[model samples]
Target: MASSPLGRPTRGTTGTNRLRRNDRWIAAADAFRRAADPLVVDLGYGASGVTAFELATRLQRVRADAEVRGLEIDPARVATATAQLEEVRAGATSFPADLRVSFARGGFEVPLPDGRRAAVIRAMNVLRQYDESDVAAAWRAMAARLAPDGLLVEGTCDEIGRVASWIDVDAAGAPQRFTLSLRLADLERPSIVAERLPKALIHRNVPGERVHALLVDLDREWDRAAALSTFGATQRFLAAVSALRDQGWAVQGGRSRWRLGELTLPWAAVSPLP
Candidate 1:
C-alpha cells in the first residue's frame, strides 16, 4: 500500500525503551486481544522503528499473527526503519525471527493495504507538539482509520519513561478512559504525571478544570498515604488510588492493575473544559 501524507512530523526523539509503559498497556488492552484483524499501527513512531518492533514482539504473546505497521511522516525516518528491519531479517540486529513488523510512511490517515483499518493505533508522545485545540480533530482523524472495533491509544510520556498517561478512544470516535502509568520505582509523586498529561488535558491542569481537581486531590492523597510508605511505594499508591475511588473519583481498574502503579479513570473526569 502507498502511504499518503496526513499529519505533521515529530521531533523523532525516541530511545531503546522510551515507550515501554505505553506498549505494556496496549499489550494488555482488549483492543489488542480481541481484534479480528490483529493489525497494530505505531503511528508517528519517531526516528527509529524499535518501538514498533517492540510492540509487534510483545503483542505476539497475546496474538501470534499480530502484525505491526510503523507509520512515520518523515520518509527519511521510514527509510532508516526499513533498513533496520532488513538487518533484522539478515540476523544482524536483535529481533524476533518471525516478527511481523513493517515500515510505512503514513500519518494519522493510517494508510494500509486492502482497505484495512488498524485494530490499535498507538500514537505516543506524538501529540505533544500540537496545540490543545488540534487534539480532538487529530483524534477524530485517527479514529476514523480504526476498524469496527479498533482502538486509539494516544498519550505522552517523559523522556526516560518514568511518567505516562493515555486516553482510550473507541472505534466510534468517543474517548472512554484516561490512564496514568507510572514507574513507581522511579516516581517521586503521582502529580509527576502532570507534566506529561495528554494533549487534551495538559493546559487544563488549573484550579477550575476537572483534571486540575483530580490531580490536586490525587497529590493530597499521595501525601496522606505517606504513612503507608513503610510497607512500600506500591502499597502507598494502592491506598491513595483506592481512596480516590472511595471519594467518588471514578477510578477504573482493580487491585491487580493498581499494584503496578496504574490508575485508570473515565475520560469524563479529565476532559477539557467545554
Candidate 2:
C-alpha cells in the first residue's frame, strides 16, 4: 500500500470566493501562464473543494486549458471534494460542467502520477498549524515537485478573504518574492496584513525584523496619504504605495496592481533577520 499523506489534516474551513484574491494572483503568474502543461495543484484545499473550482474558473480565463488538482491529506476530505466535483460536472452546481478540476489525497509531497510535476502549487492557509521552523522543509518538499519553471505560492488569508499575504518560491525552493493583497474598500490600514502573514514570517513581525519595519512604514505612509482619501481609498492606497517605493522599499508592480490593493516586493526586502 502507498504510504500515508505527508502532512497533518487541515481545519477544513472553506467558503465561496474565500480565495478570490489568491486565484487572481495565480492567474497572472508566469508559472501558470507559461507552463507547458499548466497543471496547478491546490494543496490542502480545506473541507471543501470550492476553492479549487474557483481557481480553475479564474485560471481558465487566462489559459483555456488550465487544470487544477485539489489535494488533501484527509481521505475523507478528498471524497467530499470528489462528491462536490461530481455535482459540478452534473450541472447541479454553478460551475461550468467543462471545468477541468479534480480532487485527490496527497500532501506536501504532492504525489502526482506518471512522474508529472506541477506548474504551480498553491498552499494558502495550509501552514497555519505548522511551526515556523517547519516552513523551509515544507517549501522544499513542494517546490521539488514543481516543473523547472514552476512556482509555489504559500500564504494565508482571512475567512472572508479581505486580507491576504503570500511568498512565491521558485522550483529550487528559494523564495523569490513576497506579496500582500488587501481589500481596499473601507480599509483601515495596510499594516493589517501583518496578522495574515505566512507562517515563516508571522512571528518575525516583532520589532528588529524586516517585516515589522515594512508594516510600520506601510502604516505610516497610509497615514501620510490620508489627505488623498478624499479621492477614494484606491487613490489613497496608490499614493501610499508610491511613497513607499520612493523610500527605497524596492516595491514591485505598477499602478494597475496597486489599485487593486496589492503590494509586492523581493523576498529580501522582508525576509526575517538571522
Q: Record all residue pairs in model 2 with backbone atoms less than 3 Å apart, i.e. clashing.
A: 12-47
Q: Per-residue alpha-carbon lDDT of model 1 for 1-274, expressed as tens digits?
A: 4446877899898888888888888889887898888999999989998998888888998889999999998999999999999988887877886689999888877888888889999999999999988888888989999998889999999888878899999887789999998987756779889999999989989989998898889889999999988898999899999999999999988998998889998889888778
The TM-scores, one per candidate, come to 0.97, 0.99
Task: Write candidate 2's Cα lDDT for 1-274 as tens digits.
Answer: 1268888988998999999999999999999999999999999999999999999999999999999999999888989999999899899988999999988889999998788899999999999999999999999999999999999999999999999999999999999999999999979989889889999999999999999999999999999999999999999999999999999999999999999999999999999999
- Residue 55 of model 1 has an lDDT of 87
- Which candidate's lDDT is highest? 2
Top of the candidates by TM-score: 2
Error of 2 at 227 (Å): 1.1
**Prediction 2 global C-alpha lDDT:** 0.94
Worst 10 residues of 1 by lDDT: 1-10
- Candidate 1 scores a C-alpha RMSD against the true structure in Å of 1.1
